[model samples]
Target: MKYLSFTTNCVLILSFVYVVNCANILGYFFFPGKSHQFVFQPIWKELALRGHNVTVITTDPLNEDIPNLREINVADSYSVFLNHEFSNVRRESTPPYKMILFYQEVFVDIFKMQMENKEVQDLLELPKNAFDLIILESHNKMAFGWKHKFDAPVVALSSFGLPVFSHYLHGNPIHPILYPDFLSEIRECTTLVDKVESTYFTLSCWFVVKFLIGPEADALARTYFGNDMPYLDDLEKDSMVFINANPIFSDRRPKTPDVMEFSAILPIRDTLTKDLKQILDNAKEGVVYFSLGTNVRFDHVQGDVKKNIMAALGDLPYTVICKWESESIEGQPKNVHLRKWLPQQAVLAHPNVKVFITQGGLQSSEEAIINAVPLVVIPFLGDQPLNAKILKSNGMAETISPKELNRELLRDTILTVARKENYRQRAKELRDIFLDQPQSGVDKVVWWCEYVIRHKGAKHLRSPAADISLYHYFMIDVIAVFILSFYLTFKIIQLVFAIIVGLFRRKPAEAEVSRKKKKKN
Candidate 1:
């Protein structure tokens, strides 16, 4: 009896251990940009804190001393971004074509650099190394190769919302009219010409990804993960979930079951530095927060644009806190304060901040909305124009076209947002909606991630359409068959009608000849 009791206790302990085992997760951040890293870092940190075995291949590693957490820093990829980064993207922001070039030339290079990193190469060499799941950035689909390498589930996270190309993975329909392409600057109530252009641009973007980027990425995947692995195209269909950083206020659309919106994952704290607090406290007429986001440098702005901005801010009565990279402004204003970098969220959270002049990146846009600060958006490139348009449409912001930016326009827009009570009211309303969700964004992510681990790849959540080809999904072959059937039916009907008319004409002629012969006799 004693021996049997001891065995029972041992079995119970072993079962408990099996149930409580921590999942081993691998995260791949192929994009080198800081903005992308900012969205991903919080999630990785949270996973580690929860006692999961987390390993990440990223440009911006946590660099913290944490047990059971490994971060492989591929900082070398930043040089590629620096070399390809262009400041004049505003002028060259043509839809679909320019974006295609940017992705093919710049993003492709960044991914390759990350793949060729010493750590990444070493990891690929070890076929025995395993992971429970692989998290990838949606921008670089090449990272999906890890899905096959580890034979694990893929959870794709997009820092800048889901592009039209990615909708296919979730079996989500691409309704061009309602869901405009991120790069296509078409609003819902645009003109006929704009709608046509938007549709063409949207289709063109799909073409580029399908024909240009997709094939090249497949080749790269083959090089790293080997040809024996599932085709790169098929690998994406195996994704468990798509976590997008797209705020609900930005774009309204119907998402499939597998897509999740966790845009509010970033924590918002109202704390500020002592120096910044003193500055804002001293400003009696409120303050204007200005930032062009991380990539665009103020120093690189054209001379005229700089002069116009300087003059506009110089004339404003409010204190201007601009994120300027240069050591000194050409003509400094007494009311304006220049800083190389400021704690953006902390500054925006202040009650004294009247207006936020932003370049309309997704992260900055969410920050602005959450903090209840009105905006004067000056879009530069990518999805900035669309984001700016959305904010303006919602009555929470105003926009000054880059081409039309002058001292007068800049000053007017800022004044309008700062002085207008309606913008602030609308902004506050959005903030409430954002914060009123049933659970925190972090909690939602943690729950879903654990759910995926428990279910082992979450294959039950996947759609059958996700595995189908584009031709089959759209029913191109079915349409062709119908068209051929209709043509054959029309030809048969035409032949029958011609024969009936010929017979009627011959009968009439025969009757006339018979009547003439009777009269002559």
Candidate 2:
């Protein structure tokens, strides 16, 4: 009897410790862009390494295999749409608005299906209170509706720079900073335009989601899950957000209590490839590496643009390695070699690599800074313009308009950027800023994850919702201004009317007095 009692006590203590030590973390990543994977992979890996049970719900399968990584392929068919050659439609495609519409349509259906499906339900219903915390990609605002189902703290991962959705969650003013005034741009100082624009953009986005995409998503949700999710506006106010952008690259904007900035999470590889290293070792002049990034295909570029680029390279005496999709170039120059795939980081690390010509994607930009390579950007679409603008403003890069894709402009810009020592000096300075941060990007993410696990709600750090009302949050100051203006206007108008009445009365009284004086005489 004594022996049996001791064994039972031992079992009970082990069970209690197991429950205490274990933490359940679920990450939801549904963005279509492949670049997001690089940003997310390290965080997931670090969590798993720390002995936390990490499950990643992704749209596509990841190539890297890691223990505790659970990938759920939610919308595999969307890949076909993403990889489709839209450039082949026409030389001058008449407003590809149809593409945006198609994306919205497909996304609404897939998101609804994923949320309502039995498989997802089963996952959600996993042993009672299975997860300690849920980390969602901030871009997937639709997922906010499902947060209530999980009994854990909801943390958001923003892979992009400071976005509106994240800003809203932290109870911060989204307007003035996001939508600065025209004059603000001129002054290069603070303005209310970012706030106004942010407010307008937020409402615009909500309208698009609610009226345009919400009904479809709701109907689909009802059909699949038998529940009506709340409207998009109602859903956005209740989550924590973190942006994956370095402050060094972005304007120094104030952040609310709930919002955090952790960027450049991907591991920096500064080693040179064997082939590139060999070439650089023998090079007398130096190398200039060029790439337009993965999203912008070289084949889609106009023949004239390609020829102009090649012609520009012909003028340069330095060796240029261009990462192209095709093996052959019609007007290939002697100094340029077209490779289907070249180790980008390897080339950047080469001592001979003096300058980088790029499309200014976040990862590539980060890599260039890490490797201390100056840039000449030819941005095409999306956040490329913003990135290019930031880099140019910082004196670390030069932006060349794509319209001026001629030999002379390309050659001149490349030569100027390469020869300018200021660009390299500025890039290295920014690198120092990044290195001086409190912790590595990966380490910060891991620390936050662990901190959430230790603190049940993380409520102490959360920003209050009251601080984020549309009027007060945006700081329209409508009431105070209106009252003050109304009071002043009322006083002015009242004084004017009194003066007019007095003037008429004065004339009548004076006439009566004149008549009385005449009668008396």
Candidate 3:
């Protein structure tokens, strides 16, 4: 009896320890851009630091060497599509639209490849009950399907701002009016026309994704998995989504239920070099730093636009550091220095660095605000326009459209952004707001990791799959109602016209008989 009791106690203790120690997390990170990788790295590192066995599948290699973090290279076949040839694809003449299409095609193809590859299959074949949780990049929309294959909680990380997704997880509308237009800072309330436009944009995007991208991905997934492919609904059902967005930067941030905005994940390096310290401490004239982001090529800018920016900057008395990739700026001003690469954060932190001329990438925007530097945004593609709009709305930045790139305007905008102390003050205020958040992005992610471990699975918090549908997900029902209403009105008019014609007919039966007699004759 004594021996049996001791054995039972040992068994119970062992089981508890095993449960506590077992945390296997797989992270699917398919973002191709360096900036995106940088944004997500801190959270990934944090998860690893917390003793969770973390696996990262990525297009770009990560810089950190954490023992628990496992790196898997997911090949990107869409290298041919990227506008700027950074590492691969030598040819450079492809049009932007064609390039975008090519990118879509390649992403579908690669997703299929990843789904079908022997290594990936082997990895998935690992006991479905093995992993504690799966974390994926939200942009890899297909990752949502893995929920069924694994007995684990799923989490999505958005490297960009939150908009459509707030509705996906929380069943709440992130009002489009919240995203301010760059040209107009005043709260532009959503109008009927704006709603219509938003509906059209959402539907158009859905149509493209479903008809163009979804079919191929579905076919590939089905072929590899030997089962029906998981649909968009499946993706949404399995995961708790989070956006890397700061409410302080957004114009009118909507309160969301499930999805949380933890934008402070972009970690600032605390330790500064003596030289960097001196640069910040011993500057009489203010400094200006410029970077066009990783994806954008400086050479792609038209000669006139380039000349205009250079000419405008020539008049500015501040020291300018431009991350220009081009061979030479022959008639460059003495105040401007061109470099292939510069210490971006160090420059931003410098007390002398008063203004930032940027491509309006999220990471750059976040960095500027964190370091209390005002912005002059030259937006290119994707979320840059939205970021620019947000910054402009927050009174922290001024945006100049790529189309309106000229020396006078460029100089004027720079002068306006730099001269006005309001932009700087707003940036500082946002910095405080970001810093005051409950926890750093990394810490929030770590907390989630532990929560999943404690709970076994965070299924209680997941939004119901039945609540979301294709038409409902994109708010297509609202559009359909308007269309149906118009059609019904037209049908009613046609019916009334037919009735009126019958009533106006002078002796219908006699007229019909006469017509028949004439036909017989």
Highest lDDT model number: 1
Collision count for each candidate, in order: 0, 10, 0
Better of 1 and 2 by lDDT: 1
Top of the candidates by TM-score: 1
Q: Where does candidate 1 stray beyond 4 Å?
A: 1-19, 90-95, 241-250, 484-521
Sort the predicted structures by lDDT, highest score first.
1, 3, 2
- Pairs with steric clashes in candidate 1: none
C-alpha TM-scores of all predictions = 0.88, 0.75, 0.74
Those runs of model 2 whose alpha carbons end farther than 4 Å from true positions after fitting are 1-20, 59-65, 73-128, 176-228, 232-235, 269-273, 465-521
Report the candidate with higher TM-score, 1 versus 3: 1
Q: Residue by residue across 128-225, what tens digits does model 1's lDDT show?
A: 44788788886777778898888887787777767777787678777787777766767573678767776787788788888888888888778888
> Mind sharing the TM-score for model 2?
0.75
Candidate 3: minimum summed lDDT over ten consecutive residues — where?
87-96
RMSD of each: 3.7, 6.4, 8.7
Instruction: Give the alpha carbon lDDT tens digit for every residue of 86-153 in model 3.
Output: 32211123332343345466556557656654656777878777677888877655666666567567
Q: Rank the candidates by TM-score, best first.
A: 1, 2, 3
Model 2 steric clash pairs: 175-194, 175-195, 176-194, 176-195, 178-194, 179-193, 179-194, 180-193, 180-194, 181-193
